[model samples]
Target chain A: MVKSYVEYTFKNSLPPNATVLLAAPTLPIQAEGGIPGNKGIWAGILSEMTEFALLFGVYFIARAHFPQAFKEGPLRLSLFAGTFNTVLMISGSYFVANAVLAIRQNRPRASVRWLILVLIAACGYLLTKYFEFRWNVGQGITGKTGIFFTVYYYLTFTHMVHVLWGIMGLLWVIARTRMGAYTPAEHEGMEAFASYWHATDLIWLVIFPLLYLLR
Target chain B: MKAMTHKRTIGLLWLLLVALTLGGAFLGETAAPGLAVTVIVSLTMAFKGRMVIDHFMELKTANRTIRSLMRAYFYVVPLVTVLVYLFGDRLARLTTL
Candidate 1:
């Protein structure tokens, strides 16, 4: 017979104060040793990683060939927009992670609130990115401007598309949490959404430095 | 008690992330591009990536295979970033057809 509660374990590598609960499954229970969220989501995450890896390859190669352009490219861009978007991305990931934690503790209402906060942060990212793009155009920085701008535009635009999907996923998860579709025992969908959102955040963390900070 | 602790941990991680982001910005704006800047930025990138992977993604206690894959990506990419910065001319020559 399947147990009522899933039996999972978080590594004790974290500080003792930050040790995670012994059992918290975002999805329905699988075998004793399963990945977070679920196998399906892991597959998706891996594919996303592969896609970004190729893009990073492109970025590195471009930077290699146009070192001077890469160095000066960031100077012409707005650092304010990059920093704002980074903060929003980090905050959104934080809120979503907290939402998962809240649901794990059987606090669906708190989870919903956290999810809402994540949505707001995600929306802020979109707004900031939109304005940043407009500012780029105003500065005559388009893909055709040079190899550096071309690589920057494609990498960032691809990331923005992922954020768009994450927003739609956030809406679905928020609605489900409000409807009481999740519990401490079963909330795989929300967990999957969190994982996806975090992956997007991870990609941006890398992109921000390569494009804006590494100069 | 455990839940509260985890919440606080997440909050702390977020604070650290914000601080690092600001630090990176300061370095980028003020520091000239060179080995020192490249090293610091590369290390910062790796650290930030690991924090998100292990904490926010809750992969620390995850399956060995999945966790390792994610961790490896963070490690490899940042290292490569540094390498590219240090050896761009050689890399460019090698890749040029």
Candidate 2:
């Protein structure tokens, strides 16, 4: 069944090896999903940019300066949580990123290996976040700790939700990997999704600074 | 060619993350919350974030459109100051909020 779905999608497409997305940069990849204008790449760019804009608006204008109304109630958040999360995301990103390259190299096994690592890291992220949330709740710091904590919980938790969704997407990549579905050229789905995974990780980049470091 | 040393890169990131964790913890609580350990920690976090985007996420390898979008990510850095600018009066009037 899955095989048919993949076949339907790429029946007319070039093999993954033939495409630039999986080949040497000497051959620039013409945008996949169609000719240059309305491609998956644009959709990916939009998804990332829109989210960053909204997040920046809330931080720079809606919340950051609000006259320092709220202060961090305590240094109670475990630095360990943030650290663990960062490591997990980075590790997972490596896998997904490699999976992108692996698909390019027509290395099905290598791509599968990388994707499995991505899922493993995703699972680890959820576990650590769960424990971190539990600890925060135990400390009696509600999302209502004025604006800082409010924004803190809101931003980090919201980003976590996106990471969780990214995990699901990576799982699909894993499934495709198992099915030997991607050829070198058509691995755009994997590439596009890796781009999303990295974007989600990128949000944590700011969150770590804004919430934990920017204190 | 560099041959893309994927696992080695992951190992390095883990080391950096641990350094960040320990650095933040060792700095501990500070008397000057704004100017203290947290500031250093945040700056390091920003550096780590940049590394993730540049190397791990390979935003550097992205196409021009994607590359610009990545640069657009930095738009928030200036806004850090803007938060101060926009909220100046609000900070003075913060009590009302």
Candidate 3:
């Protein structure tokens, strides 16, 4: 049964917190590294630069012709909230990144703790996000941003959904970590979890700027 | 849970963010604001985002496959932005501009 296989692996997965996976043939001697990257971890950073240029260009063209809608919408935006969330998401990413590092350093207990805090921050972020949504909806702020606000919400909320999913995954990993399923050595599970978390962080890095900060 | 200053770093980032948030709002509220407001806000936000992705999301130490997946959003952003600006209104009758 699947249970037995899991049990065997769990029991013998190189000592739940071994700093190095010496016995495992598949595991590498070190964490994966890449080029210092001009664009950093943003995978589509380069490929989509032109696309943004076009989008903003379209906005300029449209704004020049029909300035009424776009002007009104951005004028009423809550930069306060945008900035707050930007900071929150950024800070949360740092905490979660440390969680991954804790595992690498062979500290499961510490790693789980860091992840738990990150999960809390995720909840907080969702709370602020939904609160803003509620306020916007209640105030009948629909179609306020026209194209600007419309796509802004569309993109940000979609990204937030991804963040929530990442948090859920982190929670599951935390539960597993508590159960002693992973160690520094045979921690493909932890590694995979961290990867997902980083991906979430990576997306937020770009979206926050484009949506809130960019003029 | 004490993994060598996790809490402290989170705290520091939060404090910096509060300061930045106030700065952004103050600047955003200014009349006849210069381009510096936009640049400051965006740069601060971008800086924060990188921190989040690198530290909280753990991408700073991630491998190639993970990093690639994370970076995919960079493309998604511009693609969606440009496509929506150029064609979103026609496709869905949703443009306000």
Candidate that scores best on lDDT: 1
Q: What's the candidate order when arranged by decreasing DockQ?
A: 1, 3, 2
Which digits, one per residue and each the tens of the lDDT, describe model 2 over residues A1-215? 99998977775576756556545544222333222222564586467657765765565454435535433533657767876787677667666767777777789898988888888889899999889888888987678856666766777777887887788878887888779888876776776687788777777766665555444
Q: Candidate 1 residues A1-215, lDDT tens each?
A: 23422322333344565544334534422224456677898898899999999999999999999999999999998888999899999999999998988888889999999999998999899999999999999988899999889999999999999999999989999999999999887888998999999999999999999999877
Colliding residue pairs in candidate 1 = A11-B61, A26-A188, A27-A188
- Supply the DockQ value of model 2: 0.25
Residues A154-201, model 3: lDDT tens digits: 556666867877777777888988998877666666655554554555
Candidate 3 deviant stretches above 4 angstroms:
A1-70, A143-145, B1-22, B31-34, B45-97
Q: List model 1 lDDT by residue over B1-97, tens digit each.
A: 6556667888999999999998899889999889889988889889998999888887877788988999999999999999999899999999999
For each candidate, what is the lDDT?
A: 0.88, 0.64, 0.58
Angstrom error of the Cα, residue B36, model 3: value is 3.2
Off by over 4 Å in 1: A1-33
Candidate with more favorable, higher DockQ: 1 or 3: 1
Residue range B1-97, candidate 2, lDDT tens digits = 3344554665577577657655664554444555444445545655665676666555555456655556555544534433444454564455335
**Going through the candidates in order, what fraction of the true interface contacts does each contain?**
0.73, 0.31, 0.39
Residue A184's lDDT in candidate 1: 81
